[model samples]
Target chain A: METIKNLLMGFSVLLTPENMLYSFGGVLIGQIVGILPGLGSVIAIAVLLPFTYSLDPIPALVAFCGIYYGSQFGGAISSILINAPGTESAVMTTVDGYPMAKKGQAGRALGTAAISSFTGGMAGSILVVLLAGPLVQMIISFAAPEYLALMIFAMACITGMAEKSSQAKSIVAICTGLALGTIGLDVSFGAPRMTFGSLALYEGISFIILAIGVFAMAEVMRNVSNAKHNGLQRIHAMEVVGRVGISLKDWKLIIPTHIRCTLVGFFIGVLPGVGAATATPLCYSLEKKIIGEDNAEWGKGEIRGVAAPESANNSCAMGALMPLLTLGVPGSSSAAIMLTAFMILGIQPGPLLFQNHPDILWALLASFFIGNVMLLVINLPLVRYCVKLVQVPTELLFMSVWILAIVGSYAVGLRVFDVGMICILSVLGVVYGICKIPLAPMLVAILLGDMIEYYLAATIVLCRRSFVNFMSRPIVLLFLVLAVLVIVLPMLRDRFKKNKVQSAVDIIDAPE
Target chain B: MKSRQDLLFEIKVSVFLLVFALVYVILTLVGIDTSGRFLQGNAGLDPTTFPYFIGIVFTGTAFYLLVKSIYQYRLNTEKENTDAAKGIGIPVVEKKPFPFPVKASLVPYIAFIVYIATLRLFGFILDSVLLSIVILFYLNQKNRMRNIIFAIVFPVFVFLLFNKVLDVRLPIGYIFGAKY
Candidate 1:
């Protein structure tokens, strides 16, 4: 009932014309950012951050939320239409999405992605209302130990998995972040470490500067350096296989896929380290298994495959947002940037964000609910019209990316140094990408580095850093065990799969 | 044996990174005095530790990468005769070169650096417009005049939104900030 009442208040807040315009502005920019390769939510958010300095916090937040969510929605368009994944989360969607688009069900494929995104988005918003406030409360009472444990859990999921076959790259990426996090003044110990007398090092590398630079700017570098271009092949191979109209036949098929994908997306989302990027692939594979290979088109333009990943990714994107809003433990790269945003606002996220700023929280949550509905209505009939967006002339599109990057960095502090800093990090991002290093771990390491050390220091004080006391604490012990399991269990599972494959191959090769 | 170049490069980068990490860890331990003025927010638990911790992790991960990449390279040589060597992922195998937008990406990449660097000199409004025009110019975009026009106009629009409307001050770069 309280949730209902708050949402009503939230609707009233979001319904105001100014806020609605903010939401519209966010979605509009988000779509463009999402579609463009080499740019991500952080860049867009950072770019937009400066613009929001004068607005009410809620409206500013609403706009930021729009950029993040809008980017996810827009990411699908490029991933499906082109083979390139616009957002890291959209990578999996490209696997099956592009294939379906290539098979001539482009419109249907796009429609399913848009509609499924709306469904999962709505479901995530509902979950946020029920779960966020309570979760925030639970978090507020948490001692340093609990926060440390949660950070450890988040680190485990990110560093331990990252889904890539190469564990080496993932580890390297994580270590890179850990190293960077340690730079700057060691305020706890009252020392400047690693600055080497350079004043820049004392301030420490800004996460957004690094994120935008490494992820967006570096990407620009790499893309430009690469002399080859894969022109959009689907346009030439155009074939609309799925029924043109989302007829009753189409609705019957997609609705079930939509619901299933939403459940899968949300469940995956609520967990640490797993998000839409993971959920999209998981949903796609699951949908294939459920539908059976013969009837289902798995890849090759199957509507279900397209819808499942799209819906799951969108759902997962929202699902990812929930934990960050309530608990402050960001679950994805974009969420990590959002954490940076909250810090800028001087608002410590976690459970207190809900209590201290219920109006803001409620307004932001309700905006998503309405924004998502707007997405559905806008996407179904209106997205076809949004094709005009693609026609906005490439110059404007890319120029806006640069503009936003400047706007966001400057907005954070009218500091000229950060703009310089963003470029340096972008170069590093390109290097990390080249090495096949998993970025998830790096972001996690950066986010958790402070948390881990803080908790460790506190524990040392509480238990006198005594070995026995430290080892004896139940939560600490549990975290230790969980941490070991996180690393070891995944290795064992992977090794088991490898061994099984080898044995099967040997058996097949043996003379009978 | 693992090929010399890959193993050597891996070891070299790892050692450089490790040394860097050690220096950081040592400095954090030394605790240079910051006097009371610098601290603002979460500095008590040690702002240095998290990122230094990041450095340590980087060093550790680099060591891991160096060792594993070397080990895999050796294994790949022995398995070279097998079909799995070329199939799917046979770690250490080189990927086919990226085939698209080969030259076009450089346009944006260089423009980014130029735009960022010139933020103060060109002023946010002028540099933004100039950088946008230069980047689009590289893309072989046919509409140069329009592109230049938008680049100049767009930042003015951004200036209006951020500075005038939102009341957030931006670096007028050198142009607007200088005493004329």
Candidate 2:
């Protein structure tokens, strides 16, 4: 009843002519950003940030939220066609989606991705509108000690998601981030801890600089050392493609995977510090479980493979915003950036968001539903045509990306320093490509590292450094228990799997 | 054999960082004067306390890493007695590292860095022109005329977009500075 009334109120706010147009425009631009590789929502959002300063807070916020998710829908297009993930979350989508494209089922893969993304986005929005209230209350109930337990869950999730052989490397990268976070000045004590007496280092590193460097630039550099996947030319992407509807059998196979992935993505997205970059891989792995060993078409354009990852990640990506909208604690990296945007407008996002600012919140929540519907309506028909956008040649492609990055960063502060940083980071990104290390962990780490550490130190301060609060709390204990189970359960399952197979074979032999 | 090289490189970097952290710890312990004016916090509890605590943890982790890397190196070297990389089971395809369409990508990375460094000298317009041309060259197509067209058009477009419309100043280099 509460959700229904609120959603209805939200719909009323969205129906306004100006707000409706902005949402449509936001997603329309978002698709182009998605269709283009190396330029994702981060850069697109970064670019779009300055223009919205003139608008009222609600319309601006709604437009941005639309762009954020719309870009996600767009990312699936690139991955499905060229195997190039438009968004980090869409990276996993490419693993299966591109193969489908190669198989000339480009239409089917595109349709499936678009449909599943729409459903997943709806599911995630519903979670935001309804479930977020209770979730925040639950998250806030944990005392400092319990927070320590939760932070441990966050860390384990990171480790669980890390590429093996580089597991230690990921932790090292995180530790480095935690260290970098302390450089400007200690928050508690104003004394500069790591500034080394540099004038520029006093404020420490700018989040914009870090975001541009780690996410945008580093990724660019990493891409350079590799082979130019001329795979784009190979996928002719005829207009006739994307028309093949989902095969009935494929639908049956994928429906379960979609639900599972959406759940996985939504829940993971809801976790602070866990991001689409992490959630997509987790969903892909989860999809492997439902697949039959012999009949499963994994790694070769399986519908389940495409559906499970995209649906889950897109859902999860939206899930990251709930905490931001509800509690003011950012649920994801992008949400943190958006939170800053809200703060700049002097409209802090917190528990107060629901009650005091009903108009804005209503429009925002409505935009989620309306925007998602808009995205489906906007993206589906365009899927057939948008595939041709990638045919834009390489030199033109990268030049446009450079031009856009510069334009976006400069718009943020109009500071030449920002453009300078953008160019520097873009170059650095290419070099990082030469190194085998993935950039996602570094970007996510940079975003969450300081916040996690700040909260951690504050928790220690508040708890009198006591261990009892963590042990006493229900959620904290539950998280700890789950953390333990995740690490232990896999080994146990492997053992059980081996033993059961052995027994089944032995029984058959005995009858023989 | 190539995998052996990769393992060695990782081992080397890990060892180097571990050593760096250990040295930092030893120096800090022996009165390295880390408690500078900046580290001093009023009301007894200082910022130095956090730095020292984190430094100690970092030192310990680095030492543990050093030990782990050494152990891994020795174990891998012995187990691979005949020199096969511990195949994380990724079947290494015999494909050469850049088969034609691949090698062209490497140039842009260098050009990207070069453009950044030369930004002030060349101005945003000229630097962009150079960068786009370099990229076109990297793609290695016939028709210098097309490259010239892109080389000219790309920079002008970006200039009009960012500098003119957005009012974000792009460096015009020394030549434009004198003229203006």
Candidate 3:
């Protein structure tokens, strides 16, 4: 009854004209930004962070939420039309989405993606409403030790579960982030640790500057070198996108997959550090397994392939946002930026947030529900128009991106130093990309670093200067054990697989 | 054997990380004030403690990367030699050379640095407009009219959107004394 009342109150706050307009604007910008190659929710939110500085907290939250959800919708457009994913999460979609487009069922493929995304998003929001309150209540008992252990577990999970990168590279990336995080004023003692006498380094590096440099600028450098002069030709291929509505038969087919993907994605999302990048591929592979690898339709424009991932991606977004709202810990890169925005707005998200800022929390949740609906209504009809976004010339697109990145960096502090820093990071980002190092873990580490340090400091004080006392807490021990398992289990599995392969090869050689 | 590009990239990154870690360690040691270090009975209360821990971890990781990359090069070489001895036919994959831009890829980055460096003297609009045109020309974008329009419009659009509507401040030109 209280939940229903709270939801009703939330809807009342959300339906106000001003909040509604902000939500609409956020998703609108998100969709457009998502359709653009090389721009994702992270860049969108980061670039828009400075602009949100002056707005009311509710509207700011609404706009950011819109961008977050809207980008997921936009990412699928290019993946289907041009075989290029607009967001990293959309990478899985392109595998079967583009193939479906090639088969001239582009409309059906896009329709399935959009509808499944809506279903998944709704499931995620509903789960947040149902589960977050209870979860927060449970976690409220946690002390600094448990929280510190949780952060370590999250980092370990990220390093261990990163699908494509080597564990060594992931570890290096995380360590690099931790190192960068230690820059500027030490929170505990208020002493500068590594500022090197520069005032700009006093506040440490801005997350927006790092994001713009690594994602936007690094992407421009890569595209400028690898892209064809006539890369815009892919936009003409947009004509095949027929009509954007799923068939009744196809809807029936995806019903089970949608339910499974949403549950998996939402649960993974609730877990800190694991994100849509993990969820989507897991959903894809699970679907392939269910369909059986022998099935010819699995990868060759199978509607389920598009449906499963798109659903999981959006559901994951919802799941990721829950921790950021209910707890202060962010579950994904986008949520990390959102948490930064929350800090900028002078609002701390946690259990007390429900009591102290119930208005903001409820209204933000309400807007999320509305924003998903808005995205669906806005995206389906505009699929044809959104597809034309790919038609923008590379030169024009790159120039616009560069301008946005420069202007956005300047807008942050209105300082030239930020621009200089962004330029340097961009170069480093290019190098990291060339070396096959993952950038996300590093970004995650940087964002979570201060919290980790803060918790560690608090734990030390609480334990009376003995780190061993942390093990006395059951929850803390559990988190530490989980972290160890996360790091070790993958290596064990890999070694097992290697041994099995070697035995099979040996047997073949001996018999021959 | 490992590709030259792969080896060069790995070595460059390893060296860069090593240097970065080294600088971090040196700066933390020098810049941090240890006057209050012993005052806090809990070592975690000392600000330098976390930074030192991160620094050591960073240094260790960089060293591991350096050693592992070099080892991988030796292992690849041995594998190549073994394959050659067995007369195994190795597939020669065609390597795509890095597309060396006409003005070089460094041009845009350099242009951006110059723009920011000149922000106070030239202002955001003037510097941005000039940079856009220069970058487009450098990229060999052929549409002169579109380039001119975009060059003028994008900066003005960003300036107006941010400065006027968003109420964000921007740097004005010292040369023309334009206030923004």
Query: For each candidate, what's the DockQ?
Result: 0.39, 0.26, 0.55
Deviating ranges (above 4 Å) for candidate 1:
A92-104, A187-190, A196-202, A227-245, A392-396, A471-473, B1-56, B78-122, B173-180
The better-scoring model by lDDT among 1 and 3 is 3
lDDT of 2 by residue, A459-487 (tens): 66665556685456677778788767654
Ranking by DockQ: 3, 1, 2
Ranking by lDDT: 3, 1, 2
lDDT of 1 by residue, A1-512 (tens): 98899999888877889999888888777876777666778777755665655667777788888888888787877777767777877776776778867767677777777877777788777877888777776667767666677777777777565664556566666666766676675535645656668886687777777666666555555544442253211222233344433556877888888889888888788767776767877888888888898996666667777678777877787888877887788887788877887776667777877778778888999999877876666666655555445445544555566666667666665677777777777666765565455676677667766567767677657666466876676766777688778778988898999999999999999999
Best by lDDT: 3
Relative to the true structure, candidate 3 reaches a TM of 0.94
TM-score on alpha carbons, each prediction:
0.86, 0.80, 0.94
Model 1 chain A poorest 10 in a row by lDDT? A231-240
A56, model 1: CA deviation in Å? 1.1
Model 2: residue B48 alpha-carbon error in angstroms: 3.6
C-alpha lDDT values of all predictions = 0.70, 0.67, 0.82
B34-105 in candidate 3: lDDT tens per residue? 877434654545777777887888788788888877777777667778888999855575675543333355
Among all windows of 10 consecutive residues in model 3 chain A, the one with the lowest summed lDDT is: A228-237
True contacts kept of each: 0.60, 0.18, 0.63
The top-ranked prediction according to DockQ is: 3
After superposition, the stretches of candidate 3 with alpha carbons farther than 4 Å from their true spots are: A163-165, A225-235, A294-296, B1-12, B35-39, B89-103, B178-180
